[model samples]
Target: MNIRITGTGSYIPEVITKNADFDNHEFLNPDGTGFPQDNKTIIEKFKAITGIEERRYLEENLNTSDMAILAAERALENSGIDPETLDYIIVAHNYGDIKHQSFQSDTVPSIATRVKHKLRIKNPKSVGYDILFGCPGWIEGLIQAQAFIKAGMAKKCLVIGAEALSRIVDKHDRDSMIFSDGAGAVVLEETEEDGGILSHESGTFAFNEAHYIHFAKSNKTEAPDDLRYIKMNGRKIYEFALIHVPSAMKTCLENSGKSITDLKKIFIHQANEKMDEAIVKRFYKLHKMEMPKNIMPMSIKELGNSSVATIPTLYDLVLHNKIDEQKLEKGDVVMFASVGAGMNVNAMVYQH
Candidate 1:
């Protein structure tokens, strides 16, 4: 019944888009006039708040499945496991394969199936599917893999989170700066020891769903006709994370029979550096303990928000010591937490 992540891999697109790359002219007023703030001022304010300087975007011809396959291949190699041995392949994503300049998405065959095909997985028993759990999709996939292993339904599984968000994002919207594309994957296998994944918790607050990110048209008359873009109520999401995310992590730790004092690191969703910091600080405060600096590692400054890909990618970085000044040792207790669209929040406790 024991489950552990044996290997991790991630692939970020080579194209880097900096905050300053956004043009002020794109954000026009209702009357087709320019916005008050110049591009420089907007970039500064955005970086000051989100702590993001740049993010990667998939190549024009790339798709979510392509990134997922690349990451999965690396993970399989890293784990020393053959693709034929995998019993399940779970992909976490909201948008499937989306072509450039097209609003349509392909989801019928599922991105997991495409990933399986690209990886040349021949085992008929290795089922592939997708999960839609908002930004917590990747962590949710991990939770599902744990369930499968615990149920004796599978011995090995591949969990991947990939997104080609850049294709769907409306460049004219400022929120587009926070969306990017990347893929991260982990190979999970049955373990004899009780250490790996200890506990997990996930839920949704339907009332807040309307306030978070959603596809909608621009309110300005001058905006492109019939174009949909990602829109968000920043204040609402910030408040939701500050209140709900910490509570979810605390509950997860408590469920695992562990406490903040027992944790070595907290890998949070790379949504916003400031929001993540606040969430962790508030979580520790609830236990009447001061938040430890460096406990919560973040990559939002360079990776932006790739939704479900954030946790696994960050985990892979820390495991390989790619994260500056941060590394995970064997038997270390770590927690993961993420909150976003779906008004969904999730947390998991794992022993390294």
Candidate 2:
């Protein structure tokens, strides 16, 4: 069964902070790589370390729905599908419009209802569900849509990967520098059009220690705030990507009976610009193929990592930033690789 992405969209917050503003920060260092000297210092150190020239953080009152709504609206618009005719929506977000349970009671229905009400659809019925996976969530959600559509449960589905990570990031920690709030959505519809999602196979390693990041926090004073936020083994993660990601990517391609060299555009989680260069370079060297001149990396000098939003954001960036006619083509293979805390790794192949 082929599940294709027909339309894509994303949302970035409004507030922007610059690295130069961190000049007098307490943590600002003469060398620039050092830890924040103080709360003020972190602003500078964050820019220097993450290579983020500037970043957006949502206002305190904002939530995932605020960003996701914009992203979803754009996706619907780009799909050229009347919202009235849409049949399903799957949100792959860690945060929600209201509390988690509010989806059944209010939030999710409200999101779906707004489409019908705004578009004035005569028949307004669609299934809405939430798909949650770490950074791999979007690809996983895409696969889930394929399954649902294959089962004849839906006609059109919207998958969103949104996060208000800064809300949970421990302000005092170094990892906070990379956490940001954002959302991206892919609109999928079943069609015999011959140019949508083609193949998707994904796997995850179940080791409890495979990945580690801030789990949720409880009022209980058991674990400290630092433990409740982002935790990392940056070097180990790089090592894992070099080893496991290649294996995973190959597994997906092999399972789908396709070759990596045949892919027109390779999309990996944009963890960082440096990581992007290294990972793709390593893979290219191992494959004995000339480095693909067509690779489109969306990582920027700023725009600190947005986790699951990273890949879809790359798709949006490629569509808007350049004029490369050879970049991505209809029916061409698109690859996705995601590795995050819990060491969970997922790989999938999509057809444009």
Candidate 3:
């Protein structure tokens, strides 16, 4: 049951936000193209505040699915898989192209139709679906695709994770700076080859839900109300990751029968660079050994958190930047992890 990620593609909107733009706005220019003009410079204060040099977004009113469709096309093309040959499609998105998309809606899969209709995927055998999770989404989609393929139900699957954090954001809130709109797509097809997902692990600590998450307040047909939008406790998030991610990361490594020493590099959720260091520090403390020099923590800070799209975009960015030359390699373990709104925590080990 080899599931190879043969292709990777991502879409970022054209708009670029600059520090000078922020200077002119009274608020943080919730659209977020510029830095604060009155009190800050892009150099000293802005980067320190957001850890972002520049962020990207779709033009105003462009929905998430628009970005999704583009990413899907690129990934499909990159994989050399015709849309007409796709057996299944699943969308992992916090929101979609529609104004207020339904979670329970088969929109996940039906999105394939929109992709087909918009992108002209002519696959008659394709059925589309969706999954709900925040940053942990693409990993969940991969798990689902592996299940279907292993069951002999499908030959190939297009697993997409798209995010438009910009939609639910509160413009007045600085916390909103943590989000951006982007989408990523991967073509996962069954393979007889060895290098793909080797082991998977996940845990949901529901007790943390009280501090951070989203809940539906109205009928599924109704658009999300203000309260239904995503809510965050930045303090709680920092605290949760610093404490729990260490244990969870150990589990992912141990279950895969690999030690942190065996990995060439570690790629965890790029939530915050500082937070990733804390996890590495814990590993150092536990073993009385130096953390792997191969570990490089990153965040999509300028683009905000692209939610489910984070990992794939990160993966693509890594490859584009020649992560291999930087020392991530085959047979060496690559770690992927995310903690999201269900109070969920998950990590997996991959043999590159």
Best by TM-score: 1
- The regions of model 1 sitting more than 4 angstroms off are 23-25, 28-34, 208-211, 219-225
The global C-alpha lDDT for each of the candidates, from Candidate 1 onward, is 0.88, 0.65, 0.69
Report the lDDT tens digits of candidate 1 across residue range 267-321. 9999988888889999999999999878988889998999989898889888888
Q: At residue 13, give the lDDT of candidate 3.
A: 76
Candidate 1 least-lDDT 10 residues: 23-32
What TM-score fits each model? 0.96, 0.79, 0.82
Candidate 3 lDDT at 79 equals: 91
| Candidate 2 lDDT over residue span 177-219, tens digit each | 6766678887888877765665665666656546545454322
**Candidate number with the higher lDDT (2 or 3):** 3
- Order of models, best lDDT first: 1, 3, 2
* TM-score: the better of candidates 1 and 2: 1
> How many steric overlaps are in each model, in order?
0, 18, 11
In terms of TM-score, how similar is model 2 to the real structure?
Answer: 0.79
**63: Cα error in model 3, Å:** 1.8
Candidate ranking (TM-score, best to worst): 1, 3, 2
